[model samples]
Target: MPRSKRDKKVSLTKTDRKGLAWKQRIIDDIRFCVEKYPNIFVFQVQNMRNNLLKDLRQEWKKNSRFIFGKNRIMQIGLGRTKAEETETDLHKLSKRLTGQVGLLFTEKTKKEVLEWAENYWAVEYARSGFVATKTVTLPAGPLEEFTHSMEPHLRSLGLPTKLEKGVVTIYSDYTVCEEGKVLTPEQARILKLLGDPMAKFRLTMKCSWTKKDGFELHVEDSVDDNQSDSAMEEEPEDDDEKEEMEGDDE
Candidate 1:
């Protein structure tokens, strides 16, 4: 007889079963996170998982949560009804999670979390000593608006900027300032500040005004009532001086 078909089937060993169980446990943890947090960010990284985790724990211990897991498991977790039914969205987002993904969660506002991410990117870029990405020029109007929008936030970080020939330039002696462009130093510093630079800029621009009606105006320099009285008192002294002068002449 030929080799039995049952002999051809590969059975899962005890170790394989145990590994499967551990993976399931991690999936459960991910599901719990999806249900618990409202805002989630998916990050794509390469060869820096351990370092990223360390940096996150050290820098954002109080406000951040991180999880790494299989994309399918994460998508299923995101779909859970206990959460907001984000399965479809997760599926779309999972495309970028192929290489190595580290999900970031925060109890802080979304703005704060994104700001932190931007700062992290800045540090990472500095460590590599190069631009990890290329720049694309936006339309002129939008670029102008964006520059104006970020001005005050830069100012708050003490990184004043000026518009020169349609380019935003940072003002600092320690860092090289170039005409017709915002420099890398300025961009890095702005990211390090970790807030909506545009929002702060808008607020600062709005603050450049006072009420036109002058409701609270006050004057401090009024003539004193004692001025006439002092002049009257001086008249007698002047007459006495005049009489002395006449006597001296006589």
Candidate 2:
């Protein structure tokens, strides 16, 4: 009994296949950077913002390259062990790629990169669940800043806001957020409306690898030697770990 053409099932899972291709492309690109650039620095981003990073990439497009992707894929790119590492002591650098980090392959000197990163930071709105940096209290009074129509939306966000005499007003002293506290969705929204941003997107230099210096840790506690040294298994891409190729040759 031959199955009918319409009865045959077609596989729907191409995510894994696409992820592998993306990973391999990253690995190849990393290796290529190793050949093209003389130095590589692994840096951690405090608050990830694609727009800020994209701007930096454009500015350094000629002299530097940045790669942001899954840690496991990046580890495989530079190799996870001495025997497999693409460059000398890069395995040590690979171990430090443990958090929300990215690689900067560049021709710039180590001092230049360190100085730039130390002073570079951007302030942006904090999202829900972010720890508040400072307490923001709105005194009970007319919120003349907002339009009367915005009273309902403000009230829905847990604000004691109302329309009074064609003005939005708060009945009582409202604490939008408190320092050392995790923000709720409503609190975060209110803070944004009030133009109070809590998140500081900054890059901290973790470590750097060069042919002359090998692996050097710029920041203390960048990588724990006691942590697992086992090679990271290959992982499929997700929304967070999507491929980011900036200033790559390709």
Best by TM-score: 2
Poorest lDDT segment (10 consecutive residues) of candidate 2: 230-239
After superposing candidate 2 on the true structure, give the runs of residues whose Cα lies further than 4 Å from its correct spot. Answer: 1-18, 222-245, 248-250
Cα-based lDDT for every prediction: 0.40, 0.84
TM-score of the candidate numbered 2?
Answer: 0.85
What is the C-alpha lDDT profile of model 2 across 50-150, one tens digit per residue? 88888888888888999888887788888787778877788887888776888999999998999999999999999898999899999999999899889
Q: Superposing all C-alpha atoms, what RMSD in Å does each candidate have to the true structure?
A: 34.1, 5.2
Encode model 1's per-residue lDDT on 1-250: one tens digit a residue.
Answer: 7987778755556435325565566556655655555555665543243454555555655555566555444444443222334332433233233334545544555556545544543223221222424332222222243455566665565554656675555544322222344435555454434321221100000000011211111112232323432232211122111100000000
Q: In model 1, which runs have C-alpha deviations exceeding 4 angstroms?
A: 1-18, 46-49, 80-90, 122-250
Candidate 1 yields a Cα-based lDDT of 0.40
Candidate 2, overall lDDT? 0.84
